[model samples]
Target chain A: MSASDHLIPVVVSNVVEVNPIIKRFEFKHVNGDELPAFSGGAHIVVEMLDDGTKRKNPYSLMSSPFERDQYAISVRRDDTGRGGSKFMHEQVRPGMQMKISAPVNLFALDLRARKHLMIAGGIGITPFIAQMAQADKLGVPFELHYAARSVSQAAYMDSLADRFGDHVSCYCDDQGESVDLETLLSNQPLGTHVYVCGPKGMIERVVQTATSLGWPAAHVHFEHFLAPPVGEPFEVHLAKAGIDITVGAEQSLLEAVEASGTPINCMCRGGACGQCETVVVACDGEIMHNDHWLDEEQRAAKQRIMPCVSRFRGKRLELDL
Target chain B: MTIQFKDESFRGDFTYANSPSNIPRFPFPFPEDEYMYSTNIEPHHAARAGSPFENAFDVDEHYVAEMKDRALVLADDPGRCQALPHMETAGWDFLELVMVSKARDYPDLFKLTMDGDRWHWINKPLQIDDTFTFGDSSTLPCHPMEYIGRQVQGDHAILDQRDGNLWMDAGIITAQADWSLDFDIGMNFFEWHAPVPLAHELGVFQRALKFLLTLPQGQPSRRLNWTLTVNPRLDTSPENYPKWGPDRMTVTPENIGEKVHLRVELQTFWRLPRSNAILFPIRTYLMAMNEVVTQPKWGRRLHRVMRDLRPELVDYKGLSRYHPILVEWLSQFDDGAPTSPGIFPD
Candidate 1:
């Protein structure tokens, strides 16, 4: 089957400006069919075709899993980064049709945990909105520790508090309030799973603190989708597809390959999901490993590359696409 | 398309037999002359019309009888149906999947109507009409998995993904191919598959596990696995080995055609939406040698595949007792003619 056969056509039904930087878009099926059901912490890759450019961005679904008629996602516009989120904010409108990959959950709740602890930083609060809905529906005890730059900057703060009551706690940097990682990680009950999603620094602090507290590695979870960094232009030869393409300095390898009419199976266009991992058949230069899915050993092997974000800086690079 | 539900026995009487029309659609698994362990998985997209792969779930003439057999097996050993406490949401997910798929695929046989949380499901063949809340297990008579698992044909195991491995956390495995779900309930993917020979060394499980771990919702996959059984038995499980193990000795040259049956499992994997668990359905189809040879192409292919099969697989599949006799018996059907390429009748 063609890669597009699996894509669900959706209409942008509603758009809400949650904050100055965050805009929440609601998508409903183009055919008015019930969208596929998804678990909390699930994300969909929105395929955008804007100004003759194709870009796919993965956004965590902030809507309740029980809601099948429409899916909601909050996108944080990054003016300095790639333009996927900016397109969502400025170009996308109600009644506009878009294609999206099926909902995929890379950051799912560990149901076996006695309690669910979520820590969100600024725009990272998107995934937890749906996750908390699921936790509440499942009758699982959970607490949300949210840190934002300020009250006005925090997306979903009022709605979360109004719905979750004491289960929600907010920390605003403007007020000098911050989540004390050591204090929060110290006395959690056994079998508690901590999930963090946000700025890379906040995630690292949470993970390092949890590890220092002797928490089991499996009990600590985090998700950070790294936008494909702009790099120098390079040539790539797809060994199997028998195609040669130049990845522009401003384009990701995944985008360039797709532009060449060769479909690469991918979910999170950001460097998180391992779906777009391609075997590095031959490379003459250093492989720039940017994805979180690969370990140091795999990176050192130089035998694989995540095309979505990772790059190559050498002369002759061949991929088993 | 309507199915005439069969009323037959899979145990004592061994009354299960394929009709002339059903033999061609038997999913003859041996696409080539020889068979060896391989990942062999393919996307479970809808295929040719009138084939088993045409729908999300295939319900044939054996639908009613298989459900009855499942109920009997559950009654004999309630442990056949199990779900971990953490898998409750997954159980509900499985229930919703089966109900929605069956109702949509075979509206005449099954019907599902939902009014928000209240769902009304009607299984015309099984004579089941029930209304219950969607997510609340208290509304059903049993755990959601078992409740729907009994109504469907096959053994289902829900594999919970964690620690970069798939865990067999819950299942209703009354109709299995020798493995015991009770013994394998809490084992991880590698741990449960440890009994299989050769495939592990080939890195088959590792690759298969990686593929399955990232399996997206809405895209299911399937593969065919085959073994030889003594009779039309459904529960060829290790727990009941004492009851059916001796039947292997009964497969002599005289009764080879009547007694020895080719058991094919249409194993399909689906990613459940809510729990992020993989629903593995092992749907078994049994065809006696008498029914199999009814198709000339299948008869020739099975003989070649059986004769050249690896000794390790023969031993692991428990075909040693009748291996020689069955191979010799099947040799008569092979005219040394070249069979066609895919697993389909000429």
Candidate 2:
């Protein structure tokens, strides 16, 4: 990768305060470069300064890439969060600067699927927004299920309704109009693809209902906003350092390394969060790992490790680095 | 708590020799562990003691039952692993990261998501009223502008043509997205229906990143972009088509099941001043087996020692030092007087 590969910078130009709690910042290329058009389920990695913490994070994009130099991202305030949200809410503003990765898509709309069933619980509505907008434009058949606590808490209530109207379904537990996911996803059409987002609960309902209803894993697509930590512990040996860092059963190899004072540069720590990646010359054992950076063969192949969340199947092994 | 290599940074007892049976060995000339990973052609030998999943995942009856009685043992009580607690993520991490980023970025950006890689919604289609939006009907209108809009939304980010500044700001802004922490408090898989297998899915992603980050920077002077040639072992199994991506031929897993070997080039770049770069060059070669890479004796020994040292899985897994040391000793290479590598600036 070029020094340029690791140095893609993002700038904020247009800012829209979506709500008292959420603010949307539109980022663009000051160099007048063509930004990658991303699918509805793609996100980019960014690096920023926080009051207490400094690291990069993986964030999904809400705006369509159709407009020039215009990409919108929404932020909510969380003083206790690991510094990013609080920073954006209180510190980040239009004209502020940051670094980001090229767009990567994992939740793309299936054009082959004749009909799209888009579901959003709370904030999950964003990714599907582009889909909804396009479906309307193409006069395609689609449905939007917007779920929130109530009207006040919903972020884009007016815009969703104004744009899609009757085709859109709004659900608020507080208002008692919540739709049952099982029924909605039940007896689905052959070419129907499901895009479910929002809170963990809504995602869960859609997935469970769809699965119980016999929807194939490929047909049901739900995006994970936060990557939960997983995997067994592995022994990591920095042969060069002559150390036997016993990466805790719970911690990732990357975390253990940093705790051991290895200043390995990392961007997104969540495996989906790709902040910590490192190379190894000689490794032995099946790499029981987590990461989007490698394909299936590479992952099972055991060539590299995301120390933050990867592990080894057997006992201790050595890393060439 | 641990033996940090950089400088006794953390508190730990075993700086070099921990257990009486194991001995540490470092390669000659290499600066640190970072150098080793970027420039080695070591094929990860398989273990004979069966799948190492038993010790890899911290499995429960419910967790195991969920995976058709086969679960890759995650960590050892991750909530309270003895060796390095800070090295791990917590429930708060999931809530803060997963929930917060989404909540903070709220209804904008593509609600930060995690699939094989980080992804979100591009949302807003080409145009709400463009009759030829997606099907084979390419004749919607006669305009050059719509094509331009499509170009912006589809491929520029990947080309490295767009400024990285925008991503930085947007990324930083949603740093503390903790909306998930607010509601549906606790529980592992699918809290309020979160996917259980996600833990495995996530592991697959982060591990891949670690491999990429540690790879030595690529050098164009020699036209040598680091690449990986995988040779997966799959003498068994029946299903097909396991992966996907734009490079579907490479990503879309083919009929070559289990022991499948494929070659891929890593798009890593680096052109260091001629005087300083290594003679071998920087590169990382990974070989994933999709549960087919069988382990030999060394693999079995590694897994065995890992489990035996378990309960305190931290030190247990670390015990694999014996595997390599034994291998070196058993093979033609010298083991007792293994040369050490330079720790810092050389």
Candidate 3:
């Protein structure tokens, strides 16, 4: 029905519940052969079937990049989300086959860097797990600074501690501890590259701190898992289709349109890719521009919207498809 | 005046005058009675026999002082010089272009000899003489662009033409007037200049891009853009806004003469013959309002232009609070002024 549906199939061979809402799923090629190899910071879209509707969500591969027999992905169920993680949590089981896209990496380790600083928050640690392994093989020094809600919610803490010892530092909220990103970043030698994958506030703070300290933009990298909260849903009139569609409170504009039998070609679905950019023919409401694909001026123009993440509110919104 | 630091010394060749004959030979930027943003680009023209201006790449009296400032700035903050991963070739191209420009303009002071891949470059000002193979990053002290940028007075930026759009790909821009080269890198021409008001609606930037893309490979073009600054300092970037923003609001009538400057940007655009990248060099010249008033025609025309500037444009240029005081200060000389030189082509 969509570009995501045309994917290679893999079977979930094993699952492990690391935390209250987190599960580690091990996937292997359906043909029982070696899977395609990926470097650090690669993510694959796992298409989940929710009430007969497919919801493709991106998850970072936690397993070592050197391992090609299977891919390990960690999913943290968000009960308040749009039902993709919830469906994977409640419906998916071992031996179940699902379609997945090839690994796409928007964030990759700088091999030429003198050192690598990997920082993560909550489930954002998934990507760093593979990055650290790559750094180890390349003999490049690396340190992981992780922040989690609580000790129980710090997935793979024991494994990370056992493997990395003092190199892995976890700041659990329950322990009343926090990370001093400034001190960590400031002390690093020149040519040290930093990669941050975490909550929106955490990522923004790290980037701002790095920039203020005069770090080149090329040295700082980041990735986000979830889009910001969409405000009150509204009705969207497809000008070319000559039909009015109501986008629900829990659905994206793209999803709502697809439910109406019109699916737009989208790749990242996470708002990084501009494949789903749609023109705004007319609008009587304020559009919540949440996508990173648009610059400040483009967002101010209000002529186009990325329905994959951005949403609208108020009385009426018309989109030119 | 000569300044020496760490075994590197430079002699400034600046000269000023009270009579028109002894004028500093600087190009005045105003062309009309009023100022507005437009795609005012024109083909590169040769300087006439009596013209007071220099060509696209000219080393003037401020060269030594500006180079010293560049050294200090780069020493304090190296982020000002950056070349993204994909801009390695463009960096080499930019470095070669600047070296060639200097050697051509100041043959007695600088020399560049190229034989196959080996290049022997000598810079008399900085006392730098070295021979290095082309396309080797390690052979240079730093990034290629940074190596040459430290010796020049003007800031450099290289834009690659790809997919029919010009992208601000690489550069070593330490003396940024008010923009951030780091934030603007990798952005297309329109996206980078999108925040400027009236330019988009007037199609100023769009028209400039179309003209820039069609510029012949070897024939360079030039344009001039002028604005007012609170001081002569060049690092007026948004990152350091707090340091300079308050000065604009607190300037008074008496102090306005010394505190304000007429900033002129001589922007040159040319395509690199080797890499096919467009090299943009911006040399900023600042003259104190006190010194500008000495020129009878310049002072009156500048006052009129400042007084008539639109309110929205004044705010856009961050000159809202200081412009009124500047206009009032210049009004004292507007009376019984000589018939204006009349609008001249830049």
List candidate 1 stretches off by more than 4 Å: A1-5
Instruction: Write model 2 residue lDDT over B145-198, tens digit each, in one string.
Output: 222212111000000001110010000000010112112222212232232223
lDDT of 3 by residue, A230-273 (tens): 45668999988889998877677877787787657565677765
| Model 1 error, position A52 (Å) | 0.7
Model 1: lDDT equals 0.90
Q: What class would a CAPRI assessor give candidate 2's docking?
A: incorrect
> Which pairs clash inside model 3?
none
For model 1, the docking class works out as medium
| Interface RMSD, every prediction, one decimal place | 1.7, 17.2, 14.1
Write candidate 3's Cα lDDT for B1-346 as tens digits: 1212222222122222123332345557776667787776665666753333344466655566678868877787777787777566567767877787778866877899988569999988778999998778889988888888888777888887654467888887866778988789889898898888877888787668756654543356777887778766776777667877776875898788867878778888976643446789887777778877777777778888888888888888778777777888998878745545533322
The candidate 1 chain A region of ten consecutive residues with least summed lDDT is A1-10
Native contacts, share recovered per candidate: 0.69, 0.03, 0.00
lDDT for B311 in candidate 3 is 88
Q: In angstroms, how far off is B335's CA in candidate 3? A: 2.9
Candidate 1 lDDT by residue in tens digits, A217-286: 9999999955788788999999989989999886899999989988787767777767788899998999
TM of each candidate vs. truth: 0.98, 0.44, 0.50
